[model samples]
Target: MMFGQTPVTHVGVDPFNPPNPDVWPATMAPVQQILREGLDLGPVTVFVGENGSGKSTLVEGIAMAYGVNSEGGSTGAMHHSRTTESDLHSGLKLTRNPGSSKYGYFLRAETMHGFFTYLADNPSMGRPDSDYHGMSHGESFLELILNRFRGGGLWILDEPESALSFSGCLSLLSVLTQLVDGGDSQVILSTHSPMLASLPGADIYEVGPWGLRPNVWEDLELVRNWRSFMDAPQRFLKYI
Candidate 1:
């Protein structure tokens, strides 16, 4: 079942006048090449890969193309410490279902500190329960999702597992389940956590040197490696 009333139907690099390959970031090359054929999206689309695989780059581009802040937060939460954004968004295109997005947010683990700082500076934007700085990273993340994320919106998260424990991951899973199942919301996440990637009915796409490809949760390299490590920590530890 599709989650959002306005789930993204298609996304790809704009064909007419694409960025020059030489000027594009190396990380984005895979997606840029793959997007030639156009990529279809579902209610929940996930991008997964090892570090530097361009998962974040792809998701960030999508978020920017959708008009959300490149660092993190909603479109209105604009603040930039230093611009490191790639030009991929300019070359990307998104097609959503008929209805307009009610709301949107982009959360990147690495930039939440800066985002919170921005919010702190702009006290008017503060939430009633705004004490994110005092809470643990995982707690703050959960709080953001639970409070800021109203249903019937678009949420793009990058490496949320960075701050989450296993239990926190499960909590996020539950929250996401509620968001997708109970409301009209669409989520696109970039993560390495097998637990998060295993969201029931989510479409997992593996971004790598070869490009984007649909992958089964269990068959993913990250999942297999994590499972192997859990099965025998001592065996893998010998290598270290």
Candidate 2:
């Protein structure tokens, strides 16, 4: 089959064997939404929410179901540490494009240290791995993107802003833009950064207690909160 321009096009669960609501991830609003109504994806998909709002979990599930390593690595990578991943991927139904590249990478912020260690232990082909450990957090992240994230495939990231400075986030956006411009790459990013949510051509979703819903950058709670804080930090700080 000829490779298509998109990777996974939608994510849902089989109603006949849907995840139990009593379970942890299924109890989350976003997960529940996915179970009921699968998410339709685009070239760039951004998820924004507060902490513990299930955005990260939803992203992780999609990446894992798409066959990327749960601990943050490329497809078929064997970089495992203590598992905090939910079982949401176990029964996920991914609607992949008929002929998209199956290759993909997961870059979870909290697990990147271990992923770096994994990369060092298993360098690609004849080349030795770059010293990702030697670099500072932001430096390593940018280096990883520059070094590994070329070509058309899926790129799933969970809260990458955790390791990035404001400038670093912009750099990340540049790389993603280049990937999408190639017309065969799809990006799924769950982030607290308003900058990332503003990626051109991205379909933004706001994950919250009400479940995930299509949203615009200006109306996102995360964006509004950041704007409010930046406009007058004193208004919020006075409560402390």
Candidate 3:
């Protein structure tokens, strides 16, 4: 079967030690309610929202629920973690087909470097040249995505555009679009980049004060505003 459509049949937190109650974004309550409704059947799914709107929190919750690592495999620089082991979220329920896999990869911003290092050391994945390996942050970002993401499995990426230049984001988009077209891999990404959100057939869900809701990247008011402002910065800047 194709990815994403394999309906998620259960949701739960680690019982021994759970996520912190304090770190749960005020927006999470509703988002959790909606996720409990149903999983998207589309090929590529995306979550977009403001910085603190709980997009990552919800994504991590989904990963934990599915038994995927919170870090998504690659480990590099450690950033401040919001959820402690003792933290917890309840009221989760299952609603679909059940299955399990041996491989699931979660990619976060800081882990990109580590991902590449592992790839370089492991020839089975792909062997990128030193120039590609040592390229700027954006180049390395593209290289890792191209090399590491080449199979049928569950992949979750949070804020992938952090290191990518606009062109690099476009490159990642091309790769993802092609991967989805192949009909084997499934990916859920949390990002704010319009370029990334605009991938064809991507189910874009916005998480914010109102919680998660079906959305179109082009319909986001912020996208339009940013496009307009960037189009004529001098025009908008004079007012400021």
Candidate 4:
């Protein structure tokens, strides 16, 4: 409803052509387990999970399904430095809203450096007056959001907190809130930061052994763990 275009309404495993057993091991859990029920998306959706919980994998799949390059950036900016993408995208199905997306970007924190390098090599992509390479990682990241992210688009971010300071995270939260509230945009994010996940009315989903399910911000493990540690670090340290 926020994005004039139907934001991606639902997402689920395609459930066709079962993957090869040898290539994709049974021991390695697939996102299909978590997405079997099909996930209904909100204007702002946040995926939270521990490392290797398939949050990044799922976000990349969604981005690919939406036609963004596997590495990052928009559809037109195709630069693949490596082939680390999972097969999930091919097996993923997306139900989009009626109208088409006018703008879209896949911002992967892990790959932003490589993407920026690609942009620098190809000046035709419209190089900013101040080179992104010259700026700090956090500064460049903020620059990208402030400049490149023209509202009225779909945005997918993976571990954006990696390059952000606590204050930077707050700034990003403010920027994202403005985007969703004022502009016609839908955002899906995979993060470990409770701060980022606490985006007012965002739909927070926890990915774990039980799979992805709606979760409350206060109930998040990240929040709980941080709160416990901050409340009494000495207690946790004493155990160690």
Candidate 5:
């Protein structure tokens, strides 16, 4: 890796000898496909899936295999509070682009609070202190990316829409676009938000019982569902 960039070309678990056959992700069709044929990553990859479809698990495993902290943070982060993650990472393998970055960061909205505490507990040297806990959830996310996401590296985010508004997601999209445009960075994001899935120049994958299949943003089931709901809220609302 060239000082800063971590472009992973492939990720997969052992097809014949998985970490656990009866486990959740192992039983998922998408993950099973990955086990058979390791997933290939692009400069920017977006995964849209229904809940419990194994998309998050796949992203987590990939990030973990790339050496990012499981709980969330940079590659060297050791902020572990619990072992809630599955055993997928233990059996996953990553193939990085030769001379790209080896370091990266994992940002999952659900773990941001703990990650913030970790940063607070172990302050970096010679940097101005910014209290992440004091900022709004969206503000903190943008701030963290602005400060830490620079130069070149892989940035993996899981369901960041939990903390971001429409504009906030747009801001994140801009930053991510710039990162990839810098010529040595890459991004892998998983989200249910159609806005996030519509990131320009991103390769979108729809994960479901059918497995991980590529599609354009407009053709994604996620996009169509959101569009339908928006077009007729009562159609969905009346059922509820």
Candidate 6:
């Protein structure tokens, strides 16, 4: 019931560390500071930010600090983006609660489903009743939430719901709620999906050109704008 103990605190990062010429984008903005500074939570957290914000970088750093595979569970090898290591420095430090056990898992939007499939099928990985390959992408996504994700672990997911249809997203939300209610698992996710961001009690950290900060779902202009248009689609359609 107590879940392990240790909670993540400090983490190593070069926040906006100057990018090396070999990587291009000569000088991307660095994070400069830990976004989660002084912030503590019961179990779940979400990282919500725009493209190119350093969310991925920070997550990767945290993954390394906690000994989670950037690729995913059981598979430590990862084909990370060159941008991630362009100007990589190891000096970044990661601090966590002494009682908490650290575990990290990242699911990039592009290969979220595929990654899950690979893990679900791997013999060494924990076996699941559902066949990952046979399921539709959305179903497989749900399977990850229902079968693979066990509470009490630190999971880093990047755009995990891209593969899920709206219904699938709802299914994931349900599973996430169960995890948090159990007070055993902690999640750090990067996603554009409003449904995923809407999780109750979730700490939404929006990473952007400015930096990471606590945010509400409404603060995401895209969501509000889309909803506004949907309320009266005909009005916006006239322009097109």
Each model's backbone clash number: 0, 1, 5, 1, 2, 22
All candidates: CA RMSD in angstroms? 1.9, 2.4, 4.9, 2.4, 2.8, 4.5
**Clashing residue pairs for model 2:** 4-99
Candidate 1 lDDT, tens digit per residue, 126-232?
Answer: 53457889899999888878877776778899999998999999999888877777547788999999999988788998888888888899899889999999999
Predicted candidate 3 versus true structure: per-residue lDDT over 132-172, tens digit per residue:
45788887666667766775555678898898888888888
Sort every candidate by lDDT, greatest first: 2, 5, 1, 4, 3, 6
TM-score of each: 0.92, 0.96, 0.72, 0.90, 0.93, 0.74
Write candidate 5's Cα lDDT for 20-121 as tens digits: 766776888888888878888778889889898887988898888889998888889889998888778878888788988777999999999988988988
Best by TM-score: 2
| Ranking of all candidate structures by their TM-score, best first | 2, 5, 1, 4, 6, 3
Tens digits of per-residue lDDT for model 2, 1-240? 122378988889965577988888899888988898888888889998889999888889898889999999899999998988888898689888877788999998899899999899888885788899999999999999999899989999999999999999999999998898888899999998999999998899988999988988989888899999999999999999
Error of 6 at 146 (Å): 1.6
Off by over 4 Å in 2: 1-4
Q: How would you encode candidate 4's per-residue C-alpha lDDT over 1-240 as one tens digit per residue?
A: 244554688887666754444554212454656344668887899999999877888888889888888887876777889898887677668887776564678898899889888777766446443478899999999888887676567789999999999999999998888888754688899999989999877899888766677889999988999999999999899987
Give the alpha-carbon lDDT of every model. Answer: 0.82, 0.89, 0.62, 0.80, 0.85, 0.60
- Which candidate number would show the highest lDDT if scored against the true structure? 2
For model 5, the superposed segments whose C-alpha errors exceed 4 Å read 1-6, 14-17, 126-128
| Candidate 2 lDDT trough over 10 residues, lowest sum | 1-10
**Cα error of candidate 4 at position 202, Å:** 1.1
